[model samples]
Target: MNSFGQAVDASNLDKDVKSTTLHSVGDAAPDFSCRTTDSREFKLSAQMGRVVLLYFFSSSNPACFAQMKYLENEVFQKLRRRDDFQMIALGRGHAREELVQIGGEHRLTFPLAADPKQEIYTRYFSKYVPRIVVLRWDGSIAYQASGADYEGVLRLQEVLARELAAARTR
Candidate 1:
């Protein structure tokens, strides 16, 4: 739980309480049947066996942009090459071309997608920008954040660590 007394249970908590509960955590991640820059259908549930970073943000928000920039340096690059993990950049505020450009500019090899009307964000928040909800290979919620939650940043690594450990086991 955060210092704000948010439940962070990993599943459904009252929107008023703002607590995501254990059920929410283990529940099937809300699927994204959205289009990507590659014209590919990016469905969250389809990639069930892969570790995922369900990254949400708005290009117009500076904090979101800053968080992405920081992540590009701190988290993205380090996690980029892992075969078990993948990132899907989702939001409504940017055009598909613009999002593709951002990915190209950042040398991102991951899927940069558009949810122009925010079908995905509403599944997660009533309000908030740069909300990142991470997921495990089984398609369960691992962690989430809004704005610049650097303290919560380590949540990003949960997948990679699990994947690496699995790879070593194999």
Candidate 2:
């Protein structure tokens, strides 16, 4: 049971939360499926042949909003045309309606997914929102960022470019 005033069930929490181990580079990313804001399903395994930049954020977070805007203006604008790469932003443990509203407000161009149960979030790490994870073509973790900092976001872009370039050779 967590001490945040909300009743918590031990069984409901992911094992990693108890172990306090968050996935890092070289680890295999756990596959997950979630409902997009457009009501379509998104499966991580389906994007195996392409490098993916997955952003986990919260709709209500200001830092998350800034990060999304930065991504839209800087990263997604440059990479949307490429076939070997894909970007997805998931609202960390949020509902579909909330996700759609957030996307609309931010004018996000990339696909947005809802994670009401935080299943995917917990799989990567039992941490707060505004996190980014880069996954290689074979589903291995390549990079991860826990905060919405310019340097981290920029570094993610660099790492992603390198990974995408390498994936094309295979």
Candidate 3:
């Protein structure tokens, strides 16, 4: 341990920093493959050339509903329009049946994935639930946060609207 009392454990840092000697805004997102709520598998490697938003969450979190509902309204609407981009909702916990029900109840249109073993979460490089990472067409991470921020959605909407439109043509 350091004199400042912060743990001296390098292993305690984010995976991105651990794997690579450097961190930058334009780094490619780590690849991941995991099952959706309905047991369909999603592979990040296969999603190259496509914009993907990786959202990690857990059921029973009080604030999760807000994030879910917000996506259903803001981000989902954008991502589902023509598949220029994809939003992969991954649940670190909660029953698959419950995920389906909650998703349907809210009219969430994007694909809802599940990770019983947290394999996907670990692969993506985060230490908490309710985290979000937005990736661009080339698999580079465009934005990320530890939790859902209404303002973040608004900003992303603005950026994605233009990008997705351009993507549709080319």
Candidate 4:
């Protein structure tokens, strides 16, 4: 069983979608810096010692919205206060103002970043909305999941808990 109490075979996630990410688990996570909706700079390389969750989404995709809702309600709410965890939701091809508006509409507490040119998104996948990538404390990719579904979210929750626990012990 996974963190959400369902039997989750992480190995069985949609195969085709799973292969979409350019970087795989254990690979070094690509580094990038972007201005967030809140006007703060988010640099992935600076977050080395903490577990990081990168969520790439499109503001116009309904499936992405569903996934974002689950993340805000289920994941972010519970982990927001943790000093060792960071979550950033990147809006692919979205302007800063648009991201700000979306964040307000969704009541998202996590940082919403703007990747208006696909500069960041293309480094991970050529196409896909609601792509999730979890990076370990050492800056390596720990997990990757795609799609807007409960199972993917649950798997992410499980991986996050495991990674956070592992980071604590190191």
My TM-score estimates for the predictions, one after another, are 0.73, 0.85, 0.74, 0.88
Rank order (by TM-score, best first): 4, 2, 3, 1
For candidate 2, which ten residues in a row score worst on lDDT?
A: 1-10
Off by over 4 Å in 1: 1-23, 104-108, 158-170
Off by over 4 Å in 3: 1-24, 162-170
Model 3 misses residue 3 by how many Å? 31
Q: Candidate 4 residues 1-170, lDDT tens each?
A: 43222355667544545676688899999999998887899999999889999999986667777678888888888988988899999999999999888888988888999999999999998766778999999999999877666677778889999999998988
Angstrom error of the Cα, residue 22, model 2: value is 1.9
lDDT of 2 at 66: 80
Clashing pairs in 3: 36-113
lDDT of every predicted structure (CA atoms): 0.67, 0.79, 0.68, 0.85
- C-alpha RMSD values across all candidates: 5.5, 6.1, 6.3, 5.5
lDDT of 1 at 61: 65
Worst 10 residues of 1 by lDDT: 13-22
Q: lDDT for model 2, on a 0 to 1 scale?
A: 0.79
Give per-residue CA lDDT, model 3, range 1-170, as digits (tens): 32112344645434533453222447888787867766777888887767777777876564667887887777777557655678888887665777798788878877887676777677665455576777777778776655455666687676677556656666
